[model samples]
Target: MKWTEVQEIAIQLSERHPETDPAKVNFVDLMKWTMALPEFDDDPKHCGERVLEAIQQAWIDEVA
Candidate 1:
């Protein structure tokens, strides 16, 4: 998934790391985990703080 697919990525992340808390994740780790997803295919350069923040928020919402 691309960086634009924020919600999908968040869902995947939440599932991949059920024990982890999105709110406690730093952008560096968040970006790394996002890139590690098997379905993720976007360029690393395409991701930014805004996109990471959106993914983090979505992940938090997914768990909540």
Candidate 2:
């Protein structure tokens, strides 16, 4: 997805999960955390993939 779409999803997630620490909600940090997940460790493009998945999942979980 486009960076703009990713950002929009992140914002939606943040709004839904208001208890999450605001300091921890920025795009770069979230992408870093997602990339560190073990499941993506072997993927050569893990950083970008994880960032996209993280944003999407965050948005989904926010509403569920």
Best by lDDT: 1
> How far off is model 2, as Cα RMSD?
7.8
Question: Could you estimate the TM-score for every candidate?
Answer: 0.97, 0.35
What's the lDDT for all of these models?
Answer: 0.96, 0.53
lDDT of 2 by residue, 2-38 (tens): 3335555556546645567644456566665444443
lDDT of 1 by residue, 1-64 (tens): 8999999999999999999989999999999999999999989999999999999999999999
> What CA RMSD would you report for each candidate?
0.4, 7.8
TM-score of 1: 0.97
Candidate 1 Cα errors over 4 Å, as ranges: none
Root-mean-square deviation of candidate 1? 0.4
Pairs that collide, model 2: none
Count the clashes in each prediction: 0, 0
